[model samples]
Every structure is written in structure tokens, then in C-alpha cells.
Target: MKLYEFERAPNPRRVRFFIAEKGIDLASIERIQIDIGGGENRAAEFRQMNPMGTVPVLELDDGTALSETMAICRYFEGNHPEPALLGQSVIEQATIEMWNRRMEFNLLLPVAMAFRHTTGHFSDRENVFPDYGSDCGQSAQRMFDFLNDHLADNDYIAGRQFSVADITAVVSIDFARVIKMRLDPDKHARLIDWHERISARPAASV
Candidate 1:
């Protein structure tokens, strides 16, 4: 397997962390750089693999490419089920997916909008200029409060066991900090504790 990775990007870091948590010795996996600023991922050759021209694309052994960080992480879990990052039972799977979707929609998407509009990071690809910065920031903060409340009695997002939902939440929350947004530590003690625990995981640095 080959992973098209970018060192500084949080999207790719999510996938890298999943790979590490799974204990998949992909040391032999090839890594292709997709420099976002240099337009490397936008090249014609790379675009053929994924029309979106994104990083963290996983090219399987048979040469099939998987795009999207969550999709790639789920695929890895499916292929290597020992670690079981998604879930084992049907109900568990559904619940995990539910939280994962909520995290993406409520937190991750807003952070992306905030960063793109406020920082104009991808202005070249699409016009962005603080068009929705305020709304995005508000949405992120709202989601943070929601998640903080939800996680008050749980060790992880979905339940006591760790799952993909936690991965999504952690990445989204960390990414949202770019907009100076976060769950209030004073009001969200459990959420803050969860973040600290996840951050201390060795795979977190992967």
C-alpha cells in the first residue's frame, strides 16, 4: 500500500494516526508528497487518481486509490479488523458512524470554512475572503459545546471503547483551534480530559 501524505496537513495526520493505532506495519508503504501550496496535488497525473486533488489518498496493493480521510480510515479498519476501530456489532457501528458524521458536519466542516475564508489558504482554487468566518466560528463553538456535554459521562465519543468517532472528533477539535475555537476547559472538564488523554497516545504523533 502507498499513502499520499503531507506532513503538515491535519487531514493526512488523521489517516497517519489511524494507521499507527491499527499497528499496521506499513513501513514498506510508499509515500507520495502532495504539496498543497505548490500545486503538486493539482497536477494532471495526481488528479487522475482523485478528482478532488486531495492528500492522504491510500493506494491499495492492487492499485485502487481511496480518497477522504474517514473513508480511508474505515477501509483500513475493514481490511484489518483485529483492532476494530469502527465497531464490532451493528448497533455499535451505527452509533460510531453517527458521531463521526456529527463531528464532520458540526465541527470539521465549520473549521474548514473558517480557515479557508479567514486565512484564504485555498483562495487560488476557490474565491474565499472572510465570507463566512463568523458563522463558521459560531458553528464550531456550538459543536464543541454539544460534544463536551455528550462526552461528560463517556470515556470516548461513542462509548467507553475507543472508535473512529473519537478520531474524527480529536482531529476536528484540534483543527478548529486554528480559528481560536475550543471547548471551554472550565465548563467542559471531561472533554478537556479526553483531549489530553488522546493527545498523550503514541499514535497521536504518527
Candidate 2:
């Protein structure tokens, strides 16, 4: 499988983390990096693979291109069931899915909005709304507080197990930093501790 991605992007990094946690040697998979900032992702050749023009597309050997981070992840999870990140039991799966959505909606989406609207990094492709972006930054900060409280007792995002929800939370929290969102050691003690634990994992570096 060949993963078309921009490694620095949070979405691609999420998949990389999942692959590493699954005990897969990341180097074994062929990686094709698309220069997102240079409009490479929007070009005709790339758009043919993923109409949405997003990175982190996994192309199968048979020429099937799987887009979306979670979709790509689900494919791998199905293939490699051991040390399951998406979960095995029904309840575990539902719980992980719930937490993952929460992280994406409350943290990841807001952070991306904040960056796009405030910095105009993709202004060439999309409209910039500074006021709305500022609001999104404030909204994302509330999620930081929410996670801090929720993680006070839980070892992972989906409870005691390190699942895909944990991966989402970590990536969202890290990306939030781009909008100047910081999990202060004193203010977000529990969240900070959780971040440190998650970051220490070998998969986190991937």
C-alpha cells in the first residue's frame, strides 16, 4: 500500500500514529508526499484519486484509493485485528467512536477553523473569516478545559484502554497548539499529565 500524505499535517500524523501502534513498521509502506500548500493536492492527477483533494490517501495495490483518515485506518484495523485501536467488543467500539467524534468536533475542527480563518493559510482555496476564526479559537479552548476535567481520572480518552479515541485526542490537542492553545501544567494538570503519558508512547513519535 502507498500512503499519499503530507507528514506534517495532523490528519496524516493520526494515521501514522495508528499504524505505529498497530506494530507496523511505517517504513515498509510506500509514502508519496503531496505538497498541499503548493496546490499539488488540488491538481488534476491527484484529484482523480481523491475528489475531495485531501491528503493521507491510501492507495491499494489494485489501484483502489481510500481517502479520509478514519476510512484508511478502518481498513488497516480490519486487516490487523490484534492490538486493536478501534476496539474489539461492541461496547468498546461504540465508546471509542463516541470519544473520537467528540475530539474531532470540539477540538480538531475548531482548531482547523481557527487556523484557516485567522492565518489565511489556505485563503487561496477558501474564504477567510477572522472573526469567526477567533470565535473558534475560544470555542476550542473550552474543549481543552473539558478534556482536562474528563481526563482527571481516566487513563485514556476511551477509558483505561489506549484506543483510536486517544489518538484523536492527542492529535487534536497538539494541533490546537497552532492556534496558541496551550495545556498549562498548572491550569490543565490532569490533561498535561495525560498528554505527557501519550506523547511518551513510541507510536506518538510516528
Give TM-scores for every candidate, taking all chains together and pairing residue i with residue i: 0.93, 0.98
Candidate 2, superposed: residue stretches over 4 Å from native: none
Clash tally, candidates in order: 0, 0
Computed on alpha carbons, the lDDT of every model, listed in order, comes to: 0.84, 0.92
Q: Kindly list the per-residue Cα lDDT of model 1 for residues 91-160, writing each as its tens digit.
A: 9888888877887788788888898898888878888869687788888887778778888778898888
lDDT measured at residue 197 in model 1 versus the true structure, 0 to 100: 93
What clash pairs does model 1 have? none
In candidate 2, what residue range of length 10 has the lowest lDDT sum?
A: 178-187
Least accurate 10 contiguous residues by lDDT in model 1: 24-33
Q: What local lDDT does model 2 show for residue 168?
A: 88
